[model samples]
Structure formats: structure tokens, C-alpha cells
Target: MRRQVLFVGLICVTFLVNAQEEKTIDLDEVTIQASSIIRKKDRQLIFPSKDQVRRSMDGLDLTRRMSLPRLWVDPNTKSISMANGNVQLRINGVLASSLEVAALSPEDIKRVEYHDNPGLRYGEGVDIVLDYITIKRTSGGNLGVDLSHQLNTFWRADYIYGKYNRGRSEFSLSSFANGHRYKEAWQDRTEIFHTPDGTFQRTQEGISGRDYEMYWTTTANYNYTKDDDYFLNAKLNFYYYDYPHNYSSALLRNSESKMTTDLIDNNKSLNTRPSLDLYYFRKLPRKQSLAVNVVGTYSNTDSRHTYREELESIPLTDIYTKVDGKRYYPLVIGIPCAM
Candidate 1:
């Protein structure tokens, strides 16, 4: 009985030792894995969250939060451009413009991502990629206004309004107006010499008496989504511009002849653009999806330019130029399988 007792004790001791050894080995493995995970995380760049974005005022403010030196956002145009200028803008996986981004509010953004080197899937000449993910709002709207004045008599103003609902529909409207004036002065000298003809010398001084420009644009967008699988969007834009210029010059020839000339130029343009986009997605059996996209755009433009010139010794003449045209573009794409 004594020997059996001793054997049982020995077996229990051995089991305990083995169990402790296994536990120690597992702890070491887990430590290594945890250290590796930390290292991996340290190597990756962290993007901003929606909460952080909500604290910002507009897209420019959000860009400033990126903390990247190579990224820049123009305060006037509201355009984001990288250092290399090889970047593309997309909204919800659709091609977009800088104007659209400028109109976005911080609360509308979910996150922002930056890729120094993009893959072939993004197309060519894409050295960098910046993605602005938008939040899915339940039902809300936002309004924005931007105004600025410069020391050199330059000024700009913009206004935007957007709204969305939880019922798979959204709409937005934006308008912009800008105007500026500038003064300029210049001098020109000309000398002409011919073998048989006498030499001629001329000097002219010029100044811009009036230079002014005004521009306006209005844009509207409508979007619809169904069950997160289908999407439809429509956009319309209207634009107008007015420019007028006046100049006067004093001319001296042969040091004894003097003349004066006046010039006037006026231009006006109007444009309209409408676009439609559609998307359909199908889920496959093995965690896959098929997507189809179609896009169409139509544009019309009307422009008129007029110039009038009057010389001291010549008759006043007026020249007019006009342009009127329309264009259309259509695009279709399909993806059979996407993982």
C-alpha cells in the first residue's frame, strides 16, 4: 500500500509539472504575438474618426487635421491637391470633382484615408490617393457660407446647403459668386530700320482704366439608394460669367508726333450641365459581388465676346465673336466578381 501511494503521488507531480510547462510556453507565444501586433500597428498610419471630423467646420478644416505636409487645400477654390499632382478624387466610389468636396461639411465625413502609392486598380498616373468617406446620416441637413476679402481689392463668396434622409434619398444645393478688380500700367518701345527707308522710333505708355469680372454658379444633386445594393444619382449645374475691360495708351513717334488710342473689351458666357449615374450590385454565393455602373452627361454652352478699338487717326471698329455648342458623354462598366 505504501508503494502504491508513492506511485500515485509521483504521477500527480508529473502531471502538474507538464501542465505548468505548457502554460509557460503558451504565455511566451502569446507575448511574442502581442509584440508583433504592436509593431505592425506602429507601422500603419491612423486616420481621423467621424467624431474628430464633427469638430471641424468644413472640408478645409478637415484637411488641416490630416497632419500631412504634402497635402494642400486651396482656400479660394476649395480644391485639394497633392505635392505631385497625381491624384484622383472619388465620392462613394464614383469619380468626383474638387468643387464637390469643397461643398462638403465636416459632419458629413466619416473618415479620410491617404495612400502614398496606389495599385493598378485605381488606374494610371495615380501616385497618391486620398479618400473621403462620408457618414450615412439618418435625417439631417447642413448649411455653409464662406467669404473673404483681400488687401488688393479681391473678394470671394460661396454658399452651400445639403440634406439627407434615412429613406435612401438625399439632395443638395450650392451656389457661388466671386468678383474682383485690378489696375495695371505698362510701357512699350519700338524701333524700325530699313536699308532704303528712314529709321522710325516709337514709344507707347498704357494703363488699364477699368478691369472687372464676375462669376456665378448654381449646382443641385439628387441621390437614391435601395437596400444598399442599388444607387441612382442626378446632378444639374448652371454657370454665368461677365468680364469688361477698358484701356488707354499715349503714343509718340519721331519725337514730334503724339496720338492716343482707347480700347474696350466685353465678354459674357452661360453654361448648363446635367448628369445621371446608376449603380447595381449583386451578391454572390461565396462572399462575392457583381457590380454594374452607368453614367451619362449632357452640356450646353453659349458665349459672346465683343471688342471695340478707337485710334486718333483711324476709324472706330467693333469685332464680335460668338460660340454655341452642346456635348454628351456616356459610360458603362461591369464587374463580374469582386472579393
Candidate 2:
């Protein structure tokens, strides 16, 4: 009986110890699973997440990371470009310019994706695409200025502001202005021959006294998200430009006697453009999404030219031309894909 009691107690103790060990193992597994879940939430491939790339660099830094041989940045404009053509930049899947990218800070970015082979929807000659996914911050802003001087002068200033709420709503506004002045000179020679008339030659020398330009642009964007499944974005843009040029030309013709013509030309032009874009996105199960975009643009141009000429020291004639035009463009695109 004593030996049986001792054996029973040993069996009970072993059972209790085994149960405790199993419980501890289960707790450890739960903790590991929770940590893995957290890690998964912190890292995402398609969108901006708390990753090394995002935490360490800004949008411009990300662009430099491409290390493409053909990629280059314009110091004067502070814009990035590829050798083939302009680099397509998209912010949250909406068309954006390099200036917009420069305005973004690292904290504002969620992810940067470089696409060498863009989808057919992106059109032809699109060798590269840089897409920026942005995070929703409570409030943020950026300011930038670029200045260059040589024979001509160039300068630009820009500002951007953004606001976001925990309820999945975001708003941003950006504005930029630039000015330029250029000087140019050229010479032209022409020879004329006729069956009945003798051959003659003409030489013309001209200089653009002044070439001035000014440009301004403003953009406003709004985004709304519902349950991480449906998203809507709206953007409005306005642009304006003014350009003026002055020219003086001296001409000599080898006729019976040397004939001289003095000319003055003046040209002024103005352009205005306004655009609106609407984007919609719907997320489906299994990590798929559908997107639709609509864009509308309206542009207006006004130009005027004045020309005055004197032939052989005599007043010849004066000409004036004025033109005004308007254009409208509408575009729509839809894409559905799995992530």
C-alpha cells in the first residue's frame, strides 16, 4: 500500500508539471503570434509603412536611390528627369509634378515605388514611373526656393500645406511662382535669283532686346477614405503665364545700290489653364483594388505682335497681329488589379 501511494503521488506530480509546461508553451506561442501581427502591420509593400526606406529618406532621396544612368536632376528647376523624357510622377496614384515631390518630406511619405515597365494605361514612352504613397499627418507643410543666374536670370518660389484627421480625411494646398529673363542675338543671310532679274544677297542682324517670362501655379487636393475599402480624391489646379519679347533688326540688300531696312518687333503673350481631377478607388477582398480617374482641363491663350519697318531710311509700314484662343480637354481612365 505504501509503495502504491508513493507511485500515485509521483504520477500526480508529473501530470501537474506537464500541464504547467504546456500552459507556458501556449503563452509563449501567443506572444510570438502577437509580435508577428504587429510586425506585419508595420511593414507593407504597396503603401507607406514604418520601414527603413521611409524612416531614413525623403522623396528626393528616394529618387536618387534609383541610380539609373539616364536619370538626372535639373539644378535650375529642382526637377528630376530621365534622358528619354520627363519622368512620370504620381502622388497617391494621381498625376503630380517633380515640384510636388520636392515639397514632400520623409515623414509625409509612406512609400516610393519605381516602375520600369509601367502598365499600358500609362501610355507609350513611359520608361520610368515614380509613385509616392503619402501618410496622413495631422498638419504639415513645406517651403522651397530656387534661383539661378547666368546670361539670363531664373527664380522660383513654392509653398505647400497639408492637414489630416483621424477620420480618414485629408486636405492639401500648394502654390508656386517662377520668373525668367533671357537675351538672344542672331544673324541671317539670304540669296535671291530670278530668271529675268539679277542675283542679289541680303544680310540681316537682329537682337532680342529683352525676353521676360512669369509663371504661377496653384493646386488644392482633398481625399476621403471609408473603412479602408473605398477612397475618393479631388484635385483642382490653376496656372498662368506671361511672356513678352522685344526685337530689333538691321538688314542690308545688294541691289543697284545698297539698300538698308531697320525693323522693330514686339510680342506679348498670356496663357491660363485650369484643371480638375477626380479619382475613386475600391478595395476588394483578396488584396485587389479597382480605380477610376477623370480629368478635365481648360486653357486660354492671348497673344499680340507689333512690327515696324523702315526701308532705305524711309518709313515703310507697320503691322499688328492679335490672337486669342481657348481649348478644353477631357480624359478618363480605369484600372483594376490585384496587389
Quick one: best TM-score, which candidate? 2
lDDT of 2 by residue, 11-44 (tens): 1110000000111234453432222111223222
Global fold similarity of model 1 (TM-score): 0.62
Tell me how far the alpha carbon of residue 217 in candidate 1 is from the true structure, in angstroms, after superposition. Answer: 3.5
Most lDDT-accurate candidate: 2
What lDDT does each candidate get?
A: 0.59, 0.62
| Residue-wise C-alpha lDDT for candidate 1, range 199-242, written one tens digit per residue | 55554444434455677777677777665566666666666665
The C-alpha local distance difference test score for the whole of candidate 1 amounts to: 0.59
> What CA RMSD would you report for each candidate?
21.9, 21.8
